[model samples]
Target: MLVLPAVVAALSIIFAVLTVGINFNLIHSIFIRKSLNKSKSLTLFYLRFVIDGFLGLQNAIMSTFILLKFLEVEYDEPVEFLFWISWTSMNCFNVRGILVIVISLDRTLAVFMPISYHNFRRRIRNFYLAIIPLSWPIVNNIVLWGVCQFRVNIPPGCVIFTCQMNQCYISYALSFEVVSHAIIALTSLILAVKLFIWNHCTQKGPKSRDLERANYLALIDTLIIIIFDIVPAGFTVKFPALSAQFGSLILVCKMSGYALESWLVRRALKRTNDIVSVSYANNSSMIKSTGQASSNHRHHRHINNHAWQ
Candidate 1:
């Protein structure tokens, strides 16, 4: 009975640690590595990774608590501490979904209208745009906290946050997750088709190839989101009893997904850097060769003129 939950809790903590490490590295790469920061899309991805790192830490702590409970180990914490965790968790969850939607839309625009997308990106400040999505989480949690304060009571001796404490907030959050994921799924499919057609019909160049690679990475991200997030949310809603039994496993899966995403982004950035380096080397060689040829031509011309004189 407790065996499965204990195993899952252990795995969740392990994965959470891995996820946090990967996210931290990715954030550092984006900040310190100029090559990785070239793309505007990565700005949003940077924010996502930051949120993911925080969630990973939270998941680790939560999983430890769950594991202790399964082992019948007694521990105590202030109710306020648990409440803040729950509140922050809710905000992070909602904010992550919104970021996914925004990223998907950004990819779609870049694919369909490359010139316009470039112009738009240049004109608008991504940092300011980011504030819009970031604000949603705070506003949402505040409202939910207010409602819980007045209308709902935190059950005594609650070990962790559960949806039963506030079904209204849970329902709204789940709905948002479902709808946003649906949009992401549809957009990813469309981008896949468009990329396929463009690849076959149009001439492939460095820019086009880079775009394709980035979009494919985004598609992989969508798959991760659908598998870890949407599936678990659906299971929780449709099979609450079963979901409760394996909640720790679901958290582990989510942490695994986040880790995978961070690793993929890092890999893609490295590949892009290699391509840029190679292209730069080739261009430098060509320029050097051209300069040598021009210099030789001028030398020969000067000799010929002197001989004619």
Candidate 2:
């Protein structure tokens, strides 16, 4: 029964590791290229990459523990510490869910107010604000963990093996998941609608091309999130049995979102490189033309002087 989840989790871990390497390269590419170094939006992408990496690592570890305990491969006695570790990891999804919200909100803001967005992007301090949402999942899960540990008195052996929780805790967990799903869906819908309207509007004179590209990327991200995270979460809440089945698949979806972000970054970098190449070519041609014109003028002046002499 658990074999699929185990294999999926193992694969998720490998994919996550590869994602981390890819994200590192993406960030490095931005810094190494002088043109990309000035881009504040690209700098902000580092947050998403790090959060995605953390989520992947956390999910992988959580799945490993679940597999080990289920097969009785080791840890016959469930250590209190290990149980808490698993519990903490389980909450990472929620944190990632909130981070998705943060990304959506920031992208939306950039679209709505490109001028102000540029001003905001200039400050390093403002970029740190995205990290604030991390607390939401962290605090929520800690309280839930407390409820299980103190209020419910979960048996030590069943801590890992059982999904049986007090109705209150289960209700809270499901409600939280539902709420997060709703938020992600609603925000994505809003952005998609706005983008559609903007596309139709004849006058888009004020909007910067970069903002347009960013919003388009956000729209794609929202679609991906809806497919992977939101839908799976909704299904899990409605059908508890599927949670066990789709456990590692959810982790894969999370990693997929990160994969998308890395792809967007690389695409943006390529576009920038193309623009720089074209600009450099234009400048080289202009300089050569200017030099030829100056030489022609000097030659003409010499000819006139020699004729007069």
Candidate 3:
């Protein structure tokens, strides 16, 4: 028991640090470096990375606390703090689920309705659309907290074991998680199949290939979320005892998934930047060569006129 918690805590911290670092770079690249286009999809991705960073931090702290408790370290687990963390983590989780759906929809639109997608993004430069996902969890958690107060069998500490105390909230959250993930998975699968057929049936240009790549990336991202985040949530709802035994490990897996996603996005951004830079360089060279050729042509015409005169 002690060994498991200790190892999990270490892994959690390592992945948490990695996640934060990679996500920071991803945010900087997207917002600062301007490696990707300013579209709704990238906006949602930015929000996702921000939430991922927070989740990673929360997991690290919670894992450390769990390890300390297991090691018999003399420390107090404040109920208020634990409850706050639990509540905030739940809210972040909900936001992430919404984000996954939005991301999938964004990709699907880009593939199926390219012109409309481009025009809509051009018109909506602000992040007003993001408020939907951001505000959903706030409303949900308020209702949950209000209902939990009426429950007679409240847990002593609002930590890992608190799910049993707030059965209603747990059930609602788990169901939402599972259902949302299922929808996202189905959407991604259909989108992937459609994109595959489209690509196979037609001769595609660079723009088409880029869209294809984006769709595939979205598909991979959804897969990671389903495997690590959704599966764990479903299993926790079905086997609550499993959560108590392997909560730290589950957190580790979640962090690992986020870390992997951050890395993939970072690499994609770098590749895009490289391609853009090379294209710009080539265009500049072509323009310079054209200018020189025009100048030589003009000089030759001037000499010919003087000789004829």
Candidate 4:
């Protein structure tokens, strides 16, 4: 079971990076070309691409730090870069997690209450784009300030910080981190589920089915990320000795879940397409210009997004 988790994590990390790398290219193209008729869906997706890449890079940093220890070659006095990357990613992921839940809720709303969704329509997703990156600095300051104040010391090449055992209460940085992440994850999960059930009651049959699937997938993704990442990350920060091994296992689980999430999203969206296509076909409304629907750019986006992030 243990080895399986490690292997799954390594594979997931590779798969996640490969998928996100391709998506990074696509969003960059879309962002650069800047001509595609932008919809809220496209905007939210591109925004998520940015957030995922940021968090993915942070995962890389953390994985590298741990791997350095496993190889027994860490010869540094203080692994300071990790202190920042770890917490920054923590904050980034939580904030982004909230945003993902919000977007999924929006999609659910659009399906169930297309009329009512207009009220929640956002003019500037730009505000979110700016706010998420800005959150990293907040995480950074909090971590740095705590370290300076607490003076967590380890004399012999600290793989993880070794603070005074009974002084765990003094080390409140991690306590703060854990509480913040837990709150965000719990809140997002509750809202996502509530809106999804509301959707079940309100949507047309087929649209409801597709949204239900997406809603379910969204909740699953959120739960996995929380259980596998946030909870372990929290414990590891607070009690390194007790949590390190378990934390490593959790990291791997998180990476694998991320890879799986990509597939889930593609399938959910394809289901959405299926429901849309069936609705059109049943109406016998033959398109005058199938050409635009099958245009090269659209085809390219569809093909490329198969490795969706």
For all candidates in order, the CA lDDT equals 0.77, 0.64, 0.73, 0.56
Give the Å error, residue 290, model 4. 14
lDDT of 3 by residue, 1-309 (tens): 467667777787788889888887677766798665444445667788889888877776766676676666766666566666756777787888887887788788777788888898668653775787888877685667686553434354334534434767766776786788888988888888877877788646655435655676788788898888878766766887766565465677888888888888777757766777798899999999999999999999999999999
Question: How many pairs collide in each candidate, listed in order?
Answer: 0, 0, 0, 0
Question: Residue by residue across 144-251, what tens digits does model 1's lDDT show?
Answer: 767544244555455466632477676666677778889999998888788788878884675554566668778878999888877876776788788677656567
Worst 10 residues of 3 by lDDT: 150-159
> For candidate 2, lDDT tens digit of each residue in 1-309?
467766666666666666666766665656664445344554445566665656556555655665565455655554565556555655655666676677778777766775798687566464466666656765766666675453445565553413435665667766776787778778878787777777787545665556655566567666777777777766665887867764456666666666666677667657866886887899999999999999999999999999999
User: lDDT score, residue 124, model 2?
Assistant: 45
- Inter-residue clash pairs, candidate 4: none
Give the runs in model 3 whose Cα sits over 4 Å from its true position: 33-41, 115-126, 150-158, 161-165, 203-214, 233-247
TM-score of each: 0.86, 0.74, 0.86, 0.58
* Cα RMSD, model 4: 12.0
**Model 4, residue 222: C-alpha shift (Å):** 2.4
The global Cα lDDT (0 to 1) of model 2 is 0.64
